[model samples]
Target: MSQRNRDAKRSAREALRAQRERDRARAKRKRTLTVAAGVVVVLGAAAGIGVAVADHGSSGGSDSAGRVIAPKGAIGKDSLVIPVGAADAPSTLTIYEDFRCPACDAFEKTFTPTIHSLEDSGAMRTEYHLVTLIDGNLGGSGSLNAANAAACAQDQDKFRPYHDVLYSNQPDEQDDKFADSTTLLTLAGKVPGLKTPAFTACVTGGTHKPWVKKSNDAFNAAGFNSTPTVLLNGKNIYSNASLTPDSLRQMVQAANKGKKPGTVTTAPSPS
Candidate 1:
């Protein structure tokens, strides 16, 4: 009857769904590795992830999987957070997402404008905790590879646009095309000046693969079992069925009610 009760129920339902997904992942991992010719993993049924086509894989470029190379300016514990927005912003939005996550893409598409506006205005800061949920759940390296490439972009201070580009071109949940260095590099062309020698080497060498693994491990340890676990000011708002961009804005606005917005300058947007 109450909003709090409704939110609680929604959280319960989400938790149950996440548990089922985790169970399915465990079963999938236990099955002997089998690659049937022409057997493509479909998304409509598995987790209801219907999205655009692209690649998702980890096999192509993984020479640096053994090394933990955090991207430029990575902060927080173990250097796992790729932060956006001003450091002194009045509010903080923590997002744990996977590059291969359909839900995450949908969320980004729906909320990016509002989030960006808040960030640009210095009302909030976003900490992106990249994870490989789909890769672990569905058997691919797309999530990790894409996250690494995004990290590489961060090296050039281009993580924001490059991040949007990857989601804009997210592959089928089952497709491992994102694992190919060529595919990743090609996508880099979408972001201006992102395709450079250092960026290329970072993607091809999987320089941030180890860091991704560490972050994923942290995700598991934190009792989170799904992609796109979003928390605003330590409150889990994603589970609220009534959550929307406007409502999010209201919350942030209220949080920053009498506070002065930060003065950090945002990077130029991509064309």
Candidate 2:
């Protein structure tokens, strides 16, 4: 790769590290708030519960509520994994993210291009696991709503670009702007052919909400407390400060050193 590409790669890795640091701080803050809020509730009454658990469960998460309508081509048990890239790729990149997470936005902004490049080359396949940490943390349905919308996109073979679009236009963590179905539908206009009646209905009706909730439930049960928990070939790489897009590429190359590249699937993924 060129120098500029190398620089971009370094930047992506740095962003990942930075996001991890933020995740840790946020986790600590959550713990602190939980303890503090309890005391405040004992003394302040109404104000404490309102502030601590405001808008909780506003999103229709189907953890135990509705039918789990897994999207087209979803893999893994319970159809929880939304996969991209060639199915037979020698390496796998598993990512857990929330649409309303700043850490997730940072990761997508800096690392998506590299990931896309690798996917395009059939060097690796990516499995996306959507979670809703921000919904519980920040008290809104944006995480769940946006995740459902993404799942709907997957049904139309428009997930990769739509996924990128969601991150590119992510709302503030506290805003919950994405909780509105109109906003999600409007964003779909950016992706060609993704604004059809079915897509609109999916977003407006929260068609995949149950699946989103189930996926999140799995995330919580799996012991991952943070969004954007990235793993490369079953190994946690997000916490490795030395990791970079270049090194990741090298790892893929090494993994496929003596193997044939996976054939690209025929499914349409515009952009």
lDDT agreement of model 1 with the native: 0.79
Model 2 residue 7 lDDT? Answer: 70
The candidate 2 region of ten consecutive residues with least summed lDDT is 54-63
Clashes of each: 9, 0
CA lDDT, every model vs. true structure: 0.79, 0.82
* TM-score per candidate, chains pooled: 0.78, 0.80
Q: How much is the lDDT of residue 190 in candidate 1?
A: 83
The residue pairs that clash in candidate 1, if any, are 54-171, 55-177, 55-178, 56-175, 56-176, 56-177, 56-178, 57-176, 57-179
Which runs of model 2 end up more than 4 angstroms from their true locations?
1-66, 266-271
